[model samples]
Target: MDLSCFKAYDLRGRVPDQLNPVLAEKIGRAYVEITGAKKVIVGYDIRLSSPDIAEALSSGLMAAGADVFDIGLCGTEQVYFATSHYKMDGGIMVTASHNPKDHNGMKMVGPESRPISSDNGLNEIRDRVLEPFGDAPQQGRYEPLEVMSAYVDHLLGYIDAGSLSPLTIVCNAGNGGAGLVIDELEQHLPFEFVKVHHQPDGHFPNGVPNPILPENRAATADAVIAEGAAMGIAWDGDYDRCFFFDENGRFIEGYYIVGLLADQFLRKTGGGKVIHDPRLTWNTMDLVKAAGGEAIESKTGHAFIKQRMRDEDAVYGGEMSAHHYFRDFAYCDSGMIPWLLVAERLCQSGQTLSSLIDARIEAYPASGEINRTIDDPPKVIAAIEAKYSVGAKSVSHVDGVSIEFDDWRFNLRMSNTEPVVRLNVESRADIPLMEEKTEELLAEMQRLNEER
Candidate 1:
């Protein structure tokens, strides 16, 4: 059996060939056997193959003597919510989350909604799938769980609705499951929503809902401008990550959003730790300190940020890739909570989104994440580091090689899944200097790659 669908963080691959009902059922049984989970929460996205695959997974779980609590047609966070909120033993979300339409996958979490990735039980579950399975002494039952009301209530608890005044907001779901959630939250808020691509369609009429791609951002930006709204928001297929657009119909880099969210969340917490990814730092660090909060950097990725949050008991955590995690929400990332907080901030501050973000951009000019394909990433990185670290104030490798000078700093790291090396450079209130260093770094990297 082809188990190539199994990945380092989660499972994702072409459907039917690498993943299907047969493999899903085996994976489900293996999950139960490995975890000894008695009660499990199951949810799926709006993909065409999701329901059938979820059904088969549940059958195998029941066969292994684990009762299933099915939360149908929801985002990945809903599974995390139901599992931890209701005290389920574990949860599984059948979603390919912004992958190509023809692909499918699953993300699993153990007790307390802690991720079950390759470092823990995911690999064991994959290995167990190939072994034989026997029926349990007693079969387990299945029940459809209603979680939207409780989940939505939890989301609302994160912000001060009393402070929120009337404003026009644009939300583009890109024909993904985010629309279902927006519709549910709409009745309780004062904002007038300008819905674009609002319907939940497996066909993805507007294409896959990945807003990080430049091409996918136009719908939300155009809608915000066309409706004359305060701001715009977009989400990926499972609605676990959300991107932002300012009132002027300009896409805001996720790096800036991280700083904004950290400041906002710190105000509510009165002073707490904020975990952030290491790829970009100066802006977030400045804002976090001014807000009377400590900013801690963690290795990029959901699992690493979440584990660090749990360890530090941080109030909030954010990544430049649009993933935001909340301490109140089982240390799990949410697409809904971040936007709600931003909306509240707008109402209280009474300033346009651009004004709020522009000041930060001026204070800290940044080269948003840039990727380059390198023949030998390690060799090129080493050469760059030897040449660049001579007069640098400090150099560290939390996730990648980050070198800091008095006026500027840059990080160069290789992608875990691809042959591309990612770079991010920033300066203290000097856009021209930031741009110059960015160009110089790229040129040096290209020359080094040629040598390699």
Candidate 2:
């Protein structure tokens, strides 16, 4: 019931303090009241605290006159899939998602896996959770279902693996729930993949499973080189965002992967629309356009991108944050799809990960995304816009501040869930220039913030 758990995008905080059984019960009641949903699906990750939280949450949902369908031991994406697949009125995922073990949270989706963040009802949920109601509501029944096998089969339905050739790859599940899926899927897969941290260890003794952190990426890169594998892939705690390592043990940027996945999906869909975040490379734009598809840009967040995808009827969407969504998957983001497509691409083209990326590296040089902590985000953004906004070029205030030039572009924006400013810069095949411009803009951002 604590207000601190009401985040910008989702409800998240420490287990006992900000999130607990009492709080979950209130949110469940509030969710049903808000959505008028009669049936709700729920799932959790491999964290030790997840099961308890799920049970508490289920109690709350049932108390609110909602039937709770518990999909035992699954990832966040699985909840999204179940919400759409089972025609449930809504779904909730009890996962902190790459956070440390002490943390726990809930991600809710409306019917069709539509997100419910602060703008959509998180604030109202928080208010209702804190408000003292006289008595607990009537309880409904509970049912258990096994949706993992069916979800996997549904994913594999989109692409054929029979045409794939043999290749050695390394996979690191980072001791999250993804280990369970990898263990099952790898058994029938045709590729030679060396699995690491394939067991579900809630402690995550090695490290948090986030692939964005440079420290976390090292293990996957090292495993790829040590095993002499063609490529490496790692998943976050809930397996929603996938990160990749090349054959030479080099970590690839998520921006590039966006373009790669956009290309792959467009290939099969035959020129359908593709959606991408504004922060990343124009390479995705070019790739989508070149494939005879329309490219749409949206703010950098799963909720926003998914909504945009559904509105545009886009076939696929990818964000620099590593979340990829498919129209077939109810426009919800998945950490599982990127790696599967990467594996298929490797097999079909008979090329290494580096080679596949290398072919496009020349056309899409990038400085990688950078983050800066600041107090006055608006002033900093306004200063950058005043200085950088040119007459002929385009400038947009979609999510944050985005400016497009003839040969280069950059997006400087504040994080939706954090207090930091994020800057993503990319240029036309010029790494040095990209780095220089990135530094220049970052310096200006800092200077303006300091002045204010």
Candidate 3:
């Protein structure tokens, strides 16, 4: 039995060979046995193999004496929402979440939608899959649960709907599941949605919905320009993370969005803690401070951010990777809430999206996360840290080494699942300085790599 599909955070692998209905059923039973979850929320994405896999998984849950509340064909966050909102014991979302169309996986959460990563119960569940299993004495029941109406209302609650005036907004679903959500929210909002690639198709005609890549962004950017939309939004296959494009068709880096959202959320709450990743900081720190909100830095990754959000009782948390967590939403990340809040801000302030972001870009110029394939990441990173930390004002390793000077800073961190190192450099209102440092750092990393 190949259990390679089980990952550090979730399950992700090619279908049938690595993950199939049989293993899914076993995983479901294992999940029930491990967590003792009597009631479970089961949901799946728009992948071709999702329905069959979800069905098998539900069977396993029932066999293990867990009643399955099937939320059928929704985003990963929906599972998170259902599990926490309805007080379910746990939830499982069958999705690879922007992985290749041929691949499939699952994202699991325990009570209160707290992530069940390797540090928690995911690894134990994986190990238990190999053990034998028999049906419980009393079989559990299955019910088709419809929570979309309530879910949509919950999403709308995050913003002032009356303040949201008419604006042309471009939404490119990329043939993923976000369109279903946009359609549901459309009736209640005042924005004119210019829908592009708006449909649920597991075939992924416009390629996988990951807008993180430069190549994957043109469709949304072009649509924004062609339609003269106020702003454009794009989501991954599962719609858990959303990317933004300004009114001028320029893709806004997720770092800036973090700052913008922090400011917006702080205004509503009066003052609260905002959890942010360490990779990029100056901009978010500035915004949070101005908003009268306490800025707290957490190590990058959903599990870390979510846990910290829970610990600090933070009102909101964001990663430069585009995951935004909300306290009201059980500390889970939501792709939909961020956009709505941004739109409401635009409506109230009567400011264009590009104009709002341009000021921040000028205030803090950053080298958007640059990745380099280093033969030895640790050695390269350590050498870089040693050389740079000499005259630096401060050096912190909350996630990876982040060295800061009086007016400039840079974070050097290695990818969790790859042999590549990601570098981000920023300067206080100086693009040339930021660019020069970025080049200097990359060249130094190359030199360090070659020395060994």
Using all chains and alpha carbons, the TM-scores for the candidates as numbered come to 0.99, 0.96, 0.99
Tens digits of per-residue lDDT for model 3, 1-452:
99999888999999999999999999999999999999999999999999999999999999999999999999998999999999999999999999999999999999999999998999999999999999999999999999899999999999988787999999999899999999999999998999999999999999999999899999999999999999999999999999999999999999999999999999999999999999999999999999999999999999999999999999999999999999999999999999999999999999999999999999999999999999988899999999999999999999889999998999999997667899999999999999999999999999988994
Model 1 segments beyond 4 Å from truth?
Answer: none
User: Model 2: residues >4 Å from true position, as ranges?
Assistant: 134-138
**How much lDDT does candidate 2 score?**
0.85
lDDT (tens digit, per residue) of candidate 1 on 1-452: 99999998999989899999999999989999999999999999999999999999999999999999999999999999999999999999999999999899999999999999999999999999999999999998999999999999999999898999999999988888999989999999999999999998988888988998999998899889899999999999999999999999999999999999999999999999999998889999999999999999999889999999999999999999899999999999999999999999999999999999999999988999999999998999999999999999999899879999999999999886667999999999999999999999999999988882
> Residue-pair clashes per candidate, as listed?
0, 1, 0
Cα-based lDDT for every prediction: 0.94, 0.85, 0.95
Give a tens-digit lDDT track for model 2, residues 1-452. 35687788887888889888778877888887778788899998888888888898898788778899999888899999999999999999999998888888999999888999889887887777766654345667899978888898987877777877777888889998887887777766877778888887889988888988998888888888899998988999999888889999898888889888888888888899898988875889888888888999888888888888888999999987888999999998887877888888877777778887886777878777788998888888887888899662899988798898888889888988779999988888888888889889988887887883
Please give the lDDT score at residue 368 for candidate 1.
93
Candidate number achieving the greatest lDDT relative to the actual structure: 3
